[model samples]
Target: MTKPFDVKIGINPISWSNDDLPSLGGKTPLSVALAEGKAIGYQGFELGNKFPREPEALRAVLAGHGLELVSGWYSGRLARRSVEEEIEAVDTHLTLLAFNGAKVMVYGEVADSIQGTQEPLYKRPRFFHPEQWRDYADKLNAFAQHTLSRGVRVAYHHHMGAYVETPADVDRLMSLTSESVGLLFDSGHMTFAGGDAVAVLARHVGRVCHMHCKDVRPRVIRHARNRNWSFLESVINGAFTVPGDGSIDFRALIRLLYDNDYSGWLVVEAEQDPVVAPSYRYAEKGYRYLRDLVERVPLEAAREAA
Candidate 1:
């Protein structure tokens, strides 16, 4: 039987968090993601991990717009001192997101100690010191058990500067972890870290409960290479852009997910300045391209049956 292709749409609030671009959006970050999602044809949004901690209020706001929380990218780190502590933190944060309709909390940060003082964290990353992977997985398992107990799913986001920053690390961590844990595949970040986004997406498709629709510029990547720059630097230097405006092929990527029986949110996460282009221009473009990608990207499997 073919899988359903009811692709979910979302926006990242980081762009809207900018003090500039007061035009095409709202005052707060959650407001911006919800409003933009509504205006640009998105079905819902993954309330960014940094949203206000109050679940009741956030849910109220999302419900008012006829919107749903596709998922929440929980940006909590799991590599703290103890597994017990990590599980405790997840227990608290997971409940907050669940009350607001979110099913996942992305393991979203590097070992905080290693981050140093880079504003925006645009460095090459020295996360090779993941001395806690096995123990971390045990902690994550405990968290997942608690979250799933609360009727929520926990997805781990392997980032560039974070512990699991590369293909080998992602493989080591995911391979070791039990099926209780899910993964949030970020295309742009994977590519930035010299990892194959498509390969990782395909390999971990089953474990993916949610995905980020961010892409990167090959030109900027090459520039970074020439400068011997860091992954975070590439992100800061516009090495990343909206999907269609970048090098990654979403058509093929979406088709893969559609084939894998994947049915979850596809968040349009643009972590860049909206001022460089026309106000909301890149976002508007990304919105259109992703919507079209969802509706128009030939799901041969879906199409043949349709």
Candidate 2:
């Protein structure tokens, strides 16, 4: 039967080897991660630190594992840099993504971000003035428009310790930016940021071009919140986990995506200590859970229609 929504399954390599915390799964090879993820039936993968930067080499490596390049994260300093400088910085990474058939580039605003640091999560940066938001959006609009012209769209990622961490922040950013600046709706981050993923998706479904199906442990998040832990500290304490292993309702999330006719990659991204969670095991679990949900959604839709 044909599916209700057009979607592809992908996984971020952070589960195998984290980019921010090198020591977490740092010893794991890129090849092993790719092979195991491909074996779990992931159709694509997001770029990781260890992945070859050369487009041709990256292509060959993914081709070997029968996986497509689903796009990668771009640390955007558009909040502080001019549009010209931001565009110049993204050139090489953008080329790699476009060459590998990725339609969207995951853009995370890292300017003044405490995500990679030991600063408490409560210490996340914020835009205190209206002009700050406007200036940042103007720069982002120009940059996203430029990238869209080059074939790949920019999907803004609302991260934990960045300026755009809260639901209100996402709403504000979406209101300020043009349609060219698509939203990268990440469920885990949304939940961790005290927002309902379903509600957020419903509100910005039109602007959402990519998705990160990340799940979080509520108890860990509560502990982090109570103790005022850093983003990295929370991650180390197992704040994130694969779908079917955490609190987020994937069935409801997928059903909403199907209802909205969402057509893009649903990337499974959960940063966890590989030694504690076991990368391949959690990868397989997440893959099977999402695969089942995706398959079941269409059947449920047809039944309802009948």
Candidate 3:
């Protein structure tokens, strides 16, 4: 029987090539990543550094591998820039997503993010005043409204070193922003921040337009916290991995989405050393695990309905 919701499985190229730390899989070609991902049964892929910038070129490249363009990350500086300036900066990226038939765009607040730096996670910049939340949300509301007009929704990514990292921070942002600003729910980052991923999702599932099905190793996270490791340092130490390979309970997560009638791409994204976790092997494992979990949800839902 057909499922009641439309939940497509996709993967981010970060598992094969780390964008922030390019040296990890910098030698691997984009073609290889696409081919391997397609072989693993992912319906699509998120944008990566090696992807073609031109719309037509990128379309052709993905088409060749029988994959769709899920979405691409946009480093938004709305925390420090005007809504108009933010819109201007995102025009090309918005155009690419729209032209490629993508429905959502990943927007990560990078105005003061330290995820890319060697700084410790605890050293991340914080919102100094309460008014900062109102100001940032206003800008996000405007930006998201404009992007929706261009045929793509904005999914705000609350990253590890960004201003909005914890569950409380996410709650505040969601409360402040209009519904136009959707959330890109990431399981790994949420878990890494020491928040209950399921509980957080339960509170804000309605605003989830996209999701990153990333998993976290609790041991690595504990070590990182104990030793004051940077975000990248933790990633290098195998803090993140594909779902089912780590401690996350994807079955519960998928069931919740299905119960909520969620519809969008669930992307398997993990920034790990390709050498330690061979891309194809790990990617295939994640794909199969999520596929089974997603498929099982509808059956259970049907039984409940019956």
| All-Cα superposition RMSD per candidate | 3.7, 1.0, 1.0
Candidate 1 error regions (>4 Å): 1-3, 18-33, 113-116, 119-132, 225-232, 302-306
Order of the predicted models by lDDT, top scorer first: 2, 3, 1
Clashes of each: 3, 0, 0
TM-score of each: 0.84, 0.98, 0.98
What are the Cα lDDT values of the candidates? 0.69, 0.94, 0.93
Compared with the true structure, what per-residue lDDT tens digits does model 3 show for residues 146-247?
999999999999899989999999999999999999999999999999899999999999999999999999999999999999999999999999999999
| lDDT for residue 195 in candidate 3, whole number 0-100 | 93
- True lDDT of residue 230, candidate 3: 93
Model 2, 195: alpha-carbon shift in Å? 0.6
Runs in model 3 with CA error above 4 Å? 1-3
Error of 1 at 155 (Å): 1.2
Looking at model 2, report the run of 10 residues with the lowest lDDT sum: 1-10
